[model samples]
Target: MATHLITGASSGIGAAVTRRLHTRGDTLWLLARNAGRARELAAEYPGAHTLVGDLADPGRLSWAFGHQSPPQELDSLLHIAGVVELGPIGDLTPKIWNEQLAANLVGPAELTRLLLPQLRLARGHVVFVNSGAGLNAHAQWGAYAASKHGLKALADSLRWEEKPNGLRVTTVYPGRTATPMQEKVHRQEGKEYDPALWIDPESVAQTILLTLDLPRDAEIQDVTVRPGS
Candidate 1:
């Protein structure tokens, strides 16, 4: 069985992906800020592992991964955790912008950097669960858009840098997924939270699974998933 580490594993796409991996009998290290929820996942799946800590804190992230010394190298690392802060460009505050960037970009970058050696040893795949905002900026979503844009750039750079090492980097741009985060976005936009209008998190998870299941010699570098209109 392949070994994998998944961030944002307590809920949303991360949780969906965790369940899929668990059902497949893969070794999973679930990381999320919700300690109790992470434990809940662990309890539900006796073989699943949980790391409860905030990715925004480097110390916490380091400690979480350090404590879990995997007997085998990782086959995949999925960075599905993200933050969204919506506001017009003029209304965006430094704190809000920085925090979004930290959660969406910097934190993932650091965690990936720390795990590079293990990933390289296994020639593993790295998947970044990005958003449509990373491809196109919107008026009231300055902070979130900018952070996702940075994340896209980081993914592209990592892909290029790690190609020689046989480590695959994939950026998945999912458009308006149906999740708690999307509910927050809908509220911020003063619109109704309609799950039907968005893509299912499980669909996104399946796409990720497809990417991971590709032949060892082939890789899906980038993927964009959107709702059917």
Candidate 2:
């Protein structure tokens, strides 16, 4: 069975993907800031383990990994943890910009770097759970959009640079989805949250599974999913 580690594993797309992987009998290492939720997930899935730490904290992340005593190699690393701070460019404070960048870009990049040795040994795949914002920015979403755009760039650079090492990188740009994060977005926008108007997190998770299950010689470099509505 393939082994994988997923960030933001306690909810939304991350939780959905974790369930899908667990159902497929894959060994999973779940990392989330919610220790209680992570423990709940671990109890539900036989091969699932928990790493409780904030994604933005490098030292905590490293310590969490060490506590679990994970295997030397992993078949996949899914960077699904991110923060969304929506505000106008003028309204954005340095603190908001720094927090968004730390969680959405820098933290994931550093974590990936830490796992590069294991990934190289396994010739594994890396998936970045980006957003439509990663493709284009919107008003009142300057900070979040910029961070996502940076994420997109990170994925592009990683894909090109890791080619010789047989590493695959896939960036999934999903449009608005029905999740707690989306609810927050809806609140921020003063609009009603409609699940029907958004893509299902399970659908996105399934696409990720499909990419992972592709033949070793072939790779899906990028994916974009959106609601029909």
Candidate 3:
């Protein structure tokens, strides 16, 4: 079974992916922000492992992982954890921008850097769960979109730089899924959240699984999942 280290495994798309992978008997390492969260994920996934590192504090992640034992080799590193805040450019504060950037971009980069050796050993794949905002920035999506755009750049660069090592990188840009984060976005927009109107997290999970299951002869560099009409 392939081993995967997943961030944002507690809820939303991350939870869906975790459940699917666990059910398929894959080895999973779930990243949590703290010991309590790690315990919670460990209890939920049973045999799955847990790592504690706060994505909001990217600077401290190296120290945190140094204290814990991560896997020797990783078949895949799934980056799905992210934070979002919505406001007009004028109303957004430095703290808000920094918080989103840290959680969405910098944290994932640092985590990937820390795990590169393990990934290279396994000839692994890295999947970044980006957003539609990454490609197009709307009025209120400045900081979050900027972070996601940076994520796209990170994945693109990693794809080329790691090609010689047989590492594959992909960025999945999912549009307006029915997640807690989406609900928060709706609240910020003062709109109603109807689950039926958005893409299911399981659907995106399936897409991710497909990418993992594809033949080694080829790679899916980027894919976008949009809500069906």
Candidate 4:
């Protein structure tokens, strides 16, 4: 079985993927900002281990990546962890933009740098669970859009760099998902974005695992998943 490390493992799609992979006997290393949440998730799986702290903090990220123990050999890394904040361009604050950038871009970039050795050893895959906002534009989704764009660029560049080494890099741009973060954004927008109409977390996990298990010739650089409804 493959070993995977994931961020934003406290909730949303990360949580779902954690459960799915754990049941399949895959070792998981979880990274998150909240110790309590990380511990809670760790408790759910017999061998699951979590690195509790903020990824935005370089020192903290160093601690988590360099210091934390994995449940098993660390292989793939699922960059599912992200942050979304909404406001019109005129009203958006630099603090918010920087915060999201730190969480959504720098954090993942730095963590991947730290874990590249292990991933290289396994010849593993790197999954970027980015948002459609990374590919499109929205009135108040400026911060999210910028961060995701950076994330996509990062994934693409790394994909090229790792091709000779036989590592697979995929970016899954999800349109809408029924996740806690989605709910938070929906509520912030003061609109009802039906969760039922949104993509299913379990389905996303299924797709990711399937893609990861595909034959060496079958490479999907990016997969766009939009809600059916």
Name the top TM-score candidate.
3
TM-score of each: 0.94, 0.94, 0.99, 0.94
Candidate 1: minimum summed lDDT over ten consecutive residues — where? 63-72
Q: Rank the candidates by lDDT, best first.
A: 3, 1, 2, 4
lDDT of 3 by residue, 34-91 (tens): 9999999999999999999999999999999999999999999999999999999999
How accurate locally is residue 91 in candidate 4, as Cα lDDT from 0 to 100? 89
What does candidate 1 score in Cα RMSD to the true structure?
1.6
* lDDT of model 3, residue 54: 98
**Considering TM-score, which of the candidate structures 1 and 3 is the better prediction for this target?**
3
Report the Cα lDDT for candidate 4: 0.83
lDDT against the true structure, each candidate = 0.87, 0.87, 0.96, 0.83
**Which candidate number would show the highest lDDT if scored against the true structure?**
3
Task: Give RMSD to native, each candidate.
Answer: 1.6, 1.6, 0.5, 1.7
